[model samples]
Target: MTAERIPFNSYLALPEGKEFSVKFKERFPFSVNAFGLNIQHNFSDKYYMAPDKAGVEILVLGHIYDPFSGRSGEDAVLEIVEMYSESKERFYDILAKCSGRFVVFVGGKKMLEILPDACASLPVNYFSPAVVNDSNEFAVSSHAYFIREAFSLPLCSNVRSLSSTRFYHLGIRHCPADMTEVEGVKVLTPNLSLTYRAGELRAQRIFPRSNRLERDVNEVINEVSRVLLSSVDCLAWFRKPIFCALSGGVDSRMTLAATVGQRDNFQFFTFAGEGNARRDLLCTKKLSQLLSLRFEEIQLSNVHPSEEFSVLYHGLQGETRAPNVKDTFARQQYFGVNDNFEVRSSISEVSRSFVRRKFHTAEMALTADAMVPIYKRVPFSRKWHELIRQEFATWMERSSFRDVEKYGYDWLDFYYWEIRVGTWQALVLQDADYYTNPTVLFNNRKLIELMLSAPEKYRKDDTLQVMIMSTLDGDVLKTPIVKNFGKKAWFREILESSYLKAYQALIAR
Candidate 1:
């Protein structure tokens, strides 16, 4: 290895005794050439300086899923390297077009990342790994828990608990990323990110959302299938016979359908976590049978309300998608996402049906408390609501989101796809397994833009999903919708709202 002092040799245990080091400035601790070629040093190995060459430096933690073919991490980096002498735009194009669900630290004239694992794992505080301990001094880390242990300090109380609504909202200044919402079909782009140059006072780039609108479900299906096959190859590199994180919903159903001929190579896994998930479990079984694929059911029992339990399958109760899925723990370990890679469908705003009440104003999109009523039981955070507002304002000042309302959709669409699906969901799912989502692959940009830009009427109801899914198996469409499975009493919302208001009033007193 031709690196300087290898960083954190004893602390970061790599399998097979593989070592990595870099010639990065201490300020930029994680830097590697385009080939994922990194050097390790301990002041003892025979080494020589690298010959000056044209390339980009990368410092990434965890495997970075790429939509450009099946290649990932350094392999993908090497391919891009071979195509061109490194330039900021070339690196930017690769990061923007292919990378997903990783902590990236890119260097040259600038740095860029997408839900960086270090800070994504601990959204509120910057984290780093080191050989020694210093309680007061902080660094970036993949596991924030270890940093606290290393310092022998009390668990931090300076950080506020993320409300269920705000779990993956945005990685604000002091809040951990949490996962929420819908407005005129608005969902945050869990993958949208920014670029930074070390000395520059401001970010150099804020990646734009796809704006092309096509009404064809065939295009949607084709793009999804492409992401599936590519992601399957990318994920298979880590684990075998990929398992689809299947559910009864459109996202998972579409994911399965997209696999088409590849069905024999996969095992489908679904879980029942007390609510609509129970319905999802039932429907998934039926769907699995139709596909003639092996299915594994992961059930969550001993139901009770804790900080962890959530009304929404997508909740931000803790650092992971689930806080205490006790029954599924063993199964997850056996399937081992870290040990193996799994692909799941996220950003199901495939249809406008997700938007309960159409929103007309940008302010209402971000500042409306209890934006989603049925999910009101999920903890709400005015702080996060405020953050959403501030983020929109700041983003508008810097990007094209300013005229989001001028489009067929409004600010909500931009926020949801760019911030929620693009960033939040990806970060929240980090704890369970290394996951890939066809819905968010960088290469699916046009499909995504077309989905968002398609006329509102085409998107209304489950028109998009039904059109696509019915083509595969019309019978599957007959399954009961999870949230709407059992009818609720007409007064249910009234009572829930009153109870919530009284509780809030009491808290104020």
Candidate 2:
């Protein structure tokens, strides 16, 4: 018998009524409905499982790699299923070791659990109403539009009215980690698991199981390098001709170094039209020549708006701002047409003190007002500011800040991990799922924690990435890092470094 085929941009629907189910059925003819839920997705048979003797069904959307066992695709899925069947704690531990961009759905007769990857990189949004329905109706989808459309929820008035430029300036690239443009449709933040059972929906953190351990920097770097190489190897097993996104930045460089063993199966490329595209191209070309590797430049031109673009743009429901529309569209077009996997270093920022200011410290009291300046890059109306403040407060409360403190984790680093990379970068990947596949090596929870275990000084100076590159292949660093736009940019870079050093000295004193 021929196997079933699932398309891209899949969604899981558990409608409140039969009417919505019919709509979903019509939209996705190749879906499975059982245990009071319906799942329609684009994953292959390797990523899916039928209901077993225990009446449990599993579906894994996107790629997953088991670094411990060096498993990928079907084998990894089976390993996950076995671990999950054993116990939730074992499953969570396995998840911590695995690296990829995926969301796992385990559905049984009376309960359903939605587990996103460490960074929530695949974007899981569910309809969480103000009032409970006796039916225990719930809907979760990678695309928030599915939930909004199924529930017929109205767009948030505050978000819909903003112009595209204003939207971009407000830095509202996507909704807050916990919010969606559609009312009651909230995003599942990283390190948290959501459960729907007995007419109750609950979300709880699944990480930071113990207090932070300040490990030796060399030890952390050595372990991280080993895990990253394993991750790249696993990815290479599932997909061939992988493209490492080469850039002048440390993140991409570190990723490039990880591909050393799998260089034959990998190529390097940089997208044109990005802010540092030129510098990236030059650096990538030099590295390719030095390393004797294959390289390509993907020009972002001749990209006219299309009906599909319109659908995708609107489907985001104001989550993605206007300025990024074209870039997003073009990249999707390239990846969708070419059918290539792109390796990204987006999640690595968590290890490098991203979104952190020198003044911020572990001892500083965290509040919504204090976070506002860090979260927003541009000015907004008083109303918008207040709304954002409220969102931050809610996020802090929902994320269990008290637990973060108890775990001895720095609130600022945790914020960058959960709010910035977990939410922002995850949404970006979800949008990219429309056309292409992007994987991050640092998406593993254990790896991220290891990177974070290093002292703040090492993280601030890009020491983690530097050490990783040095360990993997020190020659890659022979080329100076990209300093874009000549003297002005150089001066700005020096000034920023100087300020950070000065601030650190003051704090030490």
Candidate 3:
């Protein structure tokens, strides 16, 4: 667990007979020192002992698979420490061979530190009362939210929120500290370190993805897939009981299929909406059954608009405004809602926002509802939704995506930054960071390249036709449970005949 390292003296201070607790889910290599604690989760595995080792008392909540253990948790941590610096290399080398999420704590010289993985797919949180003290550090399942709930602080707001508004139009409260849900609090960033000592605090970034795209597409995709699959396998490492979030989408289905028959240690859970309202849930169920895996479907119907709004509120926090959701009246008006009434309900105030932006209402009126009728007649609405979703996947994308040719940076970079990082940041905040691969958006590059090089073959199926044709194998296609049950033909017909045809016709015209 040494690929990433954090000093244990960051977030701990001791009170007499101080009994502290650390709790982590799906993270590993839990460690504790007199001054602080170090926990390794999915991403990295090593914990740094206090450089200034004093009587550091540490407590940690770790996983059962932790490589080291003893009669007491503190002793277990000591057992895992590499006493010799030279041997440390080999020690971590072995640790890297291990995977999963864990939490560790170390405290000494009046400091406490906790480490979560760079890609924290697991569940972990920290909460401390608003008052800062020597023994005030706490860890929970949802750090910012649990902390805010524990301390009664309003959510933080920062540039991330604004970025979401301008592009994706969603408010998010759960971005890392680099982003503010409120004024002062921040979530720790991936591959980041936080040191709290002497009533003074410091934070620094330790890991960053390389900016260069020197590697070939095959290399990039292979490496990315390895890292991602390792993450998935680690989360599914638990033996006693395991569960996965099944979204009934391509992403989640791929994840489920990869694990099917691979182990008996896994279970799948999905949320089904009432009737047709929860098409995703139904689809997920259908897919799970086909896999013959243990499954649980949690049906949710009549969810208050507030619940979705709450997720948007705390999820994106300030990142989204009323103007972001197309379903919302304000957002519709902002987008010339009247023109797309059939696509969505119309708003009477479209002219006001359009006028303020110096847009001619009459011009927009011509195309406002243009998508609705066009969408209805299109044979590829389903495929179009996916393509558009990819385009608008990240909050900052919309800014540079339009007329991408005029933009300086590679359109690939724009797509990469938005989908891989920005979108995940928003999803992580919502604790809904499921199986969406940020890197997959880059697939468009491959598709485009292939199309340019060999347009005739690529154009034969088009995008929708290609995806549908590939679904011939029920076992291989990874469709969700409901869709697999009977909706396969239904979905195919709808996507191909109605949406796909309309979509292709629009493009041809």
> Which model scores highest in TM-score?
2
- For model 2 the local lDDT of residue 365 reads 60
Q: Model 2: clashing residue pairs?
A: 7-42
Residue lDDT tens for model 2, 370-420? 565455342434555566678878877776766877898887778777777
lDDT of each: 0.42, 0.72, 0.34
Query: Per-residue lDDT for 77 in model 2?
Result: 84
Report the error of model 3 at residue 387, Å: 32
* Model 1 weakest lDDT span, ten residues long: 40-49
Q: For candidate 3, write residues 1-509 as lDDT tens digits.
A: 11221111112223324333332212223323344322322222233344433354433333312221111223334543442223633433322222223344444547655444323322233434435554445443323433343344675433343334332322222232233344444444333345556655544432221222233434333333343344344443432244455664443444443453443665566655454445666566676667676777654333233344434333322343323332232222222212110100011011012121121112221111222222123122344344333323321221323333242223332332222333233333222211111111111122222222222232222232223223322363655233322445445445434543354346422
Task: Report the C-alpha lDDT of model 1 over 1-509, residue by residue, as the tens digit.
Answer: 12222112101211122232222233124333432223211111111222236334444444455654667656765654444345645554555444444444443434323223211221211222222432222222333332233333343332324333353332221222222221111111333333333422222223443334455566665554466556555655544446667766666666666566556677788865676455677788877777677888875444443222232212222233344444334443344333333555665573353423332211334322323222223334454445444434554544455445544445555555544444444444533432122222222433455455445665655666566555654555666544333345225534555645653444211
**What C-alpha lDDT does candidate 1 achieve relative to the native structure?**
0.42
Worst 10 residues of 3 by lDDT: 339-348
Greater lDDT among 1 and 3 belongs to 1
Task: Name the regions of candidate 3 deviating beyond 4 angstroms.
Answer: 1-107, 110-113, 120-142, 145-183, 197-199, 209-237, 274-286, 301-475, 478-509
Model 2, residue 54: C-alpha shift (Å): 4.9
